[model samples]
Target chain A: MHIIEVTQLQKHFGDFKAVKGIDFFVEQDEVFGFLGPNGAGKTTTINMLTGLARPTAGTIQIAGHDGIREIKKVQRIIGIVPDESNLYDDMSGYENLVFCASLYGIKKQEREKRARQLLKQFTLDDTGSRPFKAYSKGMKRKLTIAAGIIHNPTILFLDEPTTGIDVESARQIRTMIRSLNNQGTTIFLTTHYIEDAERLCDRIGFIVEGRIIKVEETQSLLQEAQREHIVEFKVEHLDEGVIQEFLQSFNQIQVPRISDQTIRISSGRPIELMPYMEFLTSHNSKVLEAKLVHPSLEEVFVHITGVEIDRLKKEKEGKK
Target chain B: MNYRLMAYGNILKKDMQNYYLKPPNLSWGIIFPISWTLMFFLRSGSDVDIKAILPGVMALSILFGTTSMLSVTITFERKSRSFERLLLSPISLNLLMLAKTTGAIIFGIINAFIPVLFASFFVDLGGIQWTLLFSGVVLIAVTSTFLGLFIAVSVNEVFEAQTFSNFFRFPMVFLCGLFIPLEQLPRVLRPLSYLFPLTYGADILKFSVNHQASINRIVSFAILLLYAVGLFLVSTHNIKKRWIY
Candidate 1:
C-alpha cells in the first residue's frame, strides 16, 4: 500500500520557488529515501507532508488522509523527526518522550511505560534523567527519534535523522530505523548522506533544485551503471602521457588516472587484463595490483544528475 | 475524560516544568513585583493612601509577571523549534493556547497575591471586598496573559518578543491608572487610559479596595473579558498564519 502520495507539490518563498511541482509516494513498511543536497527543498517537502508548512500548491495524502485538510487525522497517524533535534532543552530525555506521548493523548501510565522502554531501546536508559541540553549530539538525535516514535504512528518521517552526529550514533540510528521498518512502520527519510541512502533505502528519489530528477528502486538504479566495468591497475611508475598513448591503441578503454602509480580504465565491454598488462610491461612498469570496481550509488547519482555529490552539497550549503 | 483537557493539562505541565519553574522565571515573577512594590511604597511616602495604591501594585504585578513570562516562554519555544512539536500534534491550537494562557494566569495570580499579602500587614483587610478583589484578579490575569500571548505571537525571536512586550507594557504602567489616576491625568490622556485593559483592571481593583461602588463592576468585568477574548482570537490567528513555515 502507498502510505504517502504527493502530487504537484510546490512551495514558494516570495519569488523563489523552493519545491517545484514534485511528485512521489512512499510504500507500506518500506524505507523510502528522499535524497538531496542541502537546499534542494527536502526539508520543505517534509514540512509540507507533516503539515508544518502550507504548500503553495499541491495535494499531499499521508496514511490514507489528506495532509492539508485532514491535518489532525494525518498528524495522528504520522510521526516526524525533524532535521533539528528540537526537544525541550530543560526537560530530561525521559520527560521529552513522555511529553510527546502525552501530546498524542496517551495515558500517563502508558506513556511512562513507553518512555522507559524507548529509553532502553535507544541506549539512553542511563541518561534518561539528564536534561536534554546536557546530552551529546548523538544522544540528542537518538532521543529525538525515540520521541517521534513514542506514539507508535503508522508512518515515521525522519528528516536527516543521523546528520552531524558521531559514527556510532549514526549506526545505532540506522539499526533502529531498520528495526522500525521490520515492525511494519513505513519510513520516509530525507538525507544528504549518500551512504545512508545507499545502505538503508529500498527506493531512492533524487531531488535536485526542488525537483525529483528520478525515483527508482535502489537495485534498478544501480543496475543502470552495471554494464560498465572499472579496471584499476597499480604500476611501479605511472605516466599519464604514456598511459593515454597506450589507451589510444584500444578504442574501447577510457583511462582515468587515480594517482602517479595508479590508473583506472573503464570500458563498456569487460576489460582484458593481458593486453593492458603487456602494454605496461613494454614501458618498464610492473603491474603491482589489479582489481575490478563496481559502480556505487554515489556514482549512479553523479551519472544520472551530472553533478558530483560533494559539489552538490557545497552548492546547497552556499544557497542556504 | 476529555482528550482536549488532557492535552491542555500535559502542555501546561510541560511548560511549567520547562519554563515557569526555572529560577530566573520564579525570581522575575515573585521577587521583582515585591521589590517594585517596596520601591513604590517608599517613594510615595507614608501620607499617601496605601489602600488606593495597593490595587495598582497588584495590577502591575499581573501585567509584568504574566506578560513577560508568557512572551519569553513562547519566543524561547519558537526559537528552539520545540514549538513545532506542539504544532504538529493532533491537539487543537485553541486548546494549546488556552493551556499556555492558563499557565501564565496561574503564575500571574500567584505573583499578584504576594504583594496583596504584604500590603495586608500595613493595612487592615477586614473592610476590603473579597468577592470583588477575587473577580478583579481573575479578569486582569486573563487579560494580561492574553495580551502577552498576543505580543509573543507577533514576533519571531526571543529578544524581539521581549522588546515588543516591554513596548506594550511600560506604557500601560504609566498611563493605565496604575501610577496615575485617570481623573488626575490631563483630559487628553484620560481617554488614552481607557484604551488600556490595565485601566479597567485598576478601576476594578480600586473599587474592591475602597469598598465604594463608583465604577460599574459589570462594565469593567465585561470590557476585560472582551479584551481577553479579542486578544485570544488575534493571537490564535497570528500563530496559525505566521508560526507555520
Candidate 2:
C-alpha cells in the first residue's frame, strides 16, 4: 500500500496559485524529494500535506487517512521539520527537543532520555543549558530536526532541511535522514539544493511555477539532462578570440583562461559537436585538449526548466 | 474530545513555559499591578477596605497585564509564523484557542492577585469573601483573554497589537469604573462606560465582593460573559478563515 498519496492537490492565496494540481506517492521507506527553485510551491505542497495548509481542491491521503477529513490521525504519525525552525530562542536545545516530545504525551523521563539520545546522535553539545539564541545556525537546525523526530513518527516531512545550514551540517542531516529511511520511515522532503536532492533522494520531482513539471529517479533525470558536447583546440600561441570564434559555432560554452591558446566550447547534442569540430579543422584551428563532462544536477535542472536555475531564482526574486 | 483537551493543555503549557523561561517578561507582568496595590496600602494603612478595590484591581490586571500580554504575545507568534506551526500540528483550532484563552485566564488571575500577598499584611485579609474574589478573578481573566484574542486576530504585528490594546487598556484603567465608580462619571459618560467590557466586569466583581447579588450585577455578568464568549468565537473563526487554506 502507498504510505503517502496526494492527488490533484491545489492551493491558492487569493489570486496567486501557490500549488496547482500536483500528484505523487511515496512508498513506506522511500526518500521522495520535491525539488524546485525558490517560490516554486514546494513548501506550499508540503504545508498542505502536513495539514498546515488546507488544499483548495483535490485530496491528500497519509497512510490511507485523508489530510482534510482525518488530519489528527495523519498528524499522529508524521514528524514535520518546517521550513523555518521556529524554535524558542529562550529555550535550550535540550529543552526544545524535550518540549516537543512532551507535546506527544511522552513522559518527562522518557523525553529527557530521547532528547539526550538525539542530541548525541546529531553530535550536539551535551551541555545544552545555554539558550537557543546562543547556538550557531547549524546547531539550531540540528536541534529542530531532533525536535521533529522526538515523537518517533512513521513518516517525516522535511521542508528545506538544509537551506540555511552549512555544508557539514547539511551532510549530517542527509546521513541522518538516510538512516531513518533505512529504519522504515518514509520521508517527503522539499529542497532547493539540487545536489543534495540528487545525492539523497530516491526520486525527485521538479516543481516549476506551482506545477510538477517533471518527476523521475535521480539517475534517469541525469541521463535525460540536455547534453552539452565540448570541443577544444590547442594552437601555437594563437589569439584567444580565434578559438572563441570556432567555439562560438556551438550555443553554450564554458570559457577558461588561455595561456597556451586552448579553448573549450560547451554546446548542445552530439550532432552540434561534429560541425564545431569540422569548422575548427577547416579554419586551421589547432585543438589541444577537449572533452565532454556529464551535466550536473543544477545543469540538468536548467536544461529541463528552460532557464538557468540561478537566473530563474533571480527572476523570481525580482517578481517578488 | 481528548485531542481537544490535550491540545488545550499543550497550548497552556507552551505559554506558561514561555513566560517562565523569560525573566524580564515575568517580572514586568507582575510589577505594575503589585505596585498599584502597594500604593493603595500605603495610603489606607490597616483602616482601608482592601476588598472594595479588589474588583477594580482585577479589571486593571486583565486590561494592562493580561489583555496586553495576550495580544502582544499572540501577535509575536503570528509574526514569527509560530502560530501557523501550532495550527498545522493537526490539533483543532477551537481546542488550541481554548487552551490559549485559558492561559490568559490563569495569567490574569496571577497578575491581579499577586498584589494580594503584599496588601494582605495591611488589610483584614481573612474577612474578605474568597468566593466573591474568585468570581471577580474569573470575570477579569475571561474578559481580558477574549479581548486579547480579538486584538491578536485583527493586528498584523506585535507593535500594532500593543498600540491597539493601549487604546482599550488606558481608558479601561480609569474610566471603565475600575478605579473610579460609574456614578463618579457624568451621567452622559456613565452610559458610555457600558461599551467597555471591563466596566461591566468591574461592576459585577465589585457588587459580588459586597455580597449584594443584585439583578443589575447579574445583567452585568451576563454582558461580560457574552462579550468574552462571543469575541472568542469570532476571533477563532476569523483566524481559521484567514490562515487556513
Candidate 3:
C-alpha cells in the first residue's frame, strides 16, 4: 500500500521553481532512497512532504489524509529527521526525547520509560545533566533520531541521515535504520550515502532537477546500468589467431591482447572466462592469474547520469 | 498531564534553573536591587519620610531587573540559538512569550519587594496604609514586566532590546518619583508624567500607605492596567507572524 502519495507538486521560490510538478509514492514497510545531486530539489520536496514547506500547487496525501488541509494529522503519522535541524540546546539528551514525547500528549511516566530504553538502544549514557550544547555531533544526531521515532509513526522520513558523522557512527546509524525497517516501519530516506542506499534500500528513486529519472529495485537498476561487461584477463602467452576461433564459442568476444607476454581476454561472464582460460591452457598458454570485477554503483551512477558525482559534489560545495 | 499547564510550569522551572545555575549572577542580581533600595533610603532620608523612598526603592529595582537582566536573558538565548528550538516546539507563539514574560514578572516581584519589606521593619511609618502599598507593588511589577516583554519583541536583536528598553525604562522610574519628587517636576513635565503608567503606579502606592488619595491616582491605575493588556496583545501579534510564515 502507498503510505505517501505526492502528485504534481510544485514549489517556486520567487522566480526559481524549486519543485516542478514531480510525482512519486512510498509503499509499506519498504526502505526507499532518493538519490540526487545537491541542487536537485531533494530537500525542497522532502520539506513539502514533511509540512515544513507549503507547496504552491499540488496534492500530497499521507495515509489518505490531505497533507495541506489536514497538516496536523499528516505530521502525526510521519516522523521526520530533518537535515541540520537542531535539538533543544538547554535540555539534556534524555530531556530532549521527553520534550518531543510531551508534544504528542504522551504520559510522562511512559515517556521516561521509552527514553531510557532508547538511550540503551543507542548505547548512549550522559555523565550528568549535560546540556545538548555540550554533546558531540554524532551523539546529537543519535538523540534526534531517537526523538523522531519515539512516537512510532507508520513512516520515517530521514534526510541526509549521516551527513557529518564519523564512519563508525554512520555504520551504527545504518544498523539502527535496518532494525527500524525490520519492524514494519516504512523508511523513506534521502541520502548522499550511495553505498548505504545500494546495500540497504529495496528500491531507489534517482531524482535530479525536480524529476525522478528512474525508480527500480536496486539489483535491477544496477543490471540495467550495466547490461554488457568488458572482462580483462592476463596470461603468460597467447596465440592470437586461435583465440579468435575460441572467441566464436561465445555470442560476443573481443580479440585478445598480447603485450609483454601477458594475454588479456575480454568477455561478459566469468563462466565464459573458464572456457577461454581452458583453451589458452591447452594451447600451451601459460596461465598466471585471473580476477573478475563487477561494475560498482559509483561507476553505474556515472554511466546513467553522465557526470561524476564527486566532481558535482565539489562544484556544489564551491558554489556554497 | 494538562499540556498547557505543563508547558507553563516547565518554562518557569527553566528560568529558576537558569537563575540557580549561576550563583554569581544570582548574588549580583539580589545585591543590585538591595543596594538601590538602601541608597534611595539614605539619600532622601531628611527631606521626605522613608515611606516615600519605600515606593521609590521598590520601583527602582523593578525597573532595573525587568529592563536590564530580562533583556540580557533573551539576548543570551538568541546568541546560544536556544530560541529557535523553542519556536519549533508545538507550543503556540503566545504561550512562549507569556512564559518568558511571566517568568520575568516573578523575578521582578522578588527583586523589587523583598527588600522593601525588610527595610520597613527598620523605619516606623505612623498611620501608614499597608493594604494600599501591597496593591501598588502588584501594579508596578505587572507594568514593568510587560514593558520588558514588549521591548524584547520589538527590538530586532537582543542587544537592541537593551538599548531601546532603556529609552522607556529609565524615564519611567524618574517620572514615577523614584528620585526627584513628582511635585517638584516642572509643571509642564508633571502633566507628561500623567501620560506615563508608572506615575499612577507610584502615586497609588504613596496614597495607599500614606493616606493621600486623589481622583487622578485612581485614573492612573486604570491606565496602567490598560498598558499591561496592550503590550501583551502587541507582543502576541509579533510572535504569531513569526511562526505562521
- Which candidate has the top score in lDDT? 1
lDDT by candidate, in order shown: 0.86, 0.75, 0.71
Which candidate gets the maximum TM-score versus the true structure?
1
* Tens-digit per-residue lDDT, A1-320, candidate 3: 99888899998878988788888888889999888877888888887777666788999988899987776676666777877646667678888777667655567798888888888888776522578778887877888788888878788888888877877778889999999999998999987767878887998887777777777788887776465454555667666665656566543664334344444444454445677677778777767876654665654554445445445456435532
The alpha-carbon deviation from the true structure for residue A227 of candidate 1, after best TM-score superposition, in angstroms, is 2.4
What are the per-residue Cα lDDT tens digits for candidate 1 across B139-171? Answer: 999999999999999988888988998898888
Highest DockQ, which number? 1
lDDT of 1 by residue, A133-203 (tens): 99999999999999999999999999988878889999999999999999999999987677798889999
Sorted by lDDT, highest first, which candidate order results?
A: 1, 2, 3
Each model's DockQ? Answer: 0.60, 0.39, 0.13
- lDDT by residue (B1-245, candidate 2, tens digit) is 35455556766887888863368767866787676766777888956567777666656866677777788778888777667657766567777787777777777777777667655766666556677667867886887888888988888988889888888778767778766777778877876787888777776666656554323766877888899888888998878777764
- Ranked by TM-score from best down, the candidates are 1, 2, 3
Superposition error at A139 for model 1 (Å): 1.0
Residue B174 alpha-carbon offset, candidate 1, angstroms: 1.3
Query: Model 2: how far is A184 from its true place, Å?
Result: 1.0
Between which residue pairs do clashes occur in model 2? Answer: A233-A287, A233-A288, A234-A286, A234-A287, A234-A288
Q: What is the lDDT, from 0 to 100, of the residue B234 in candidate 1? A: 95
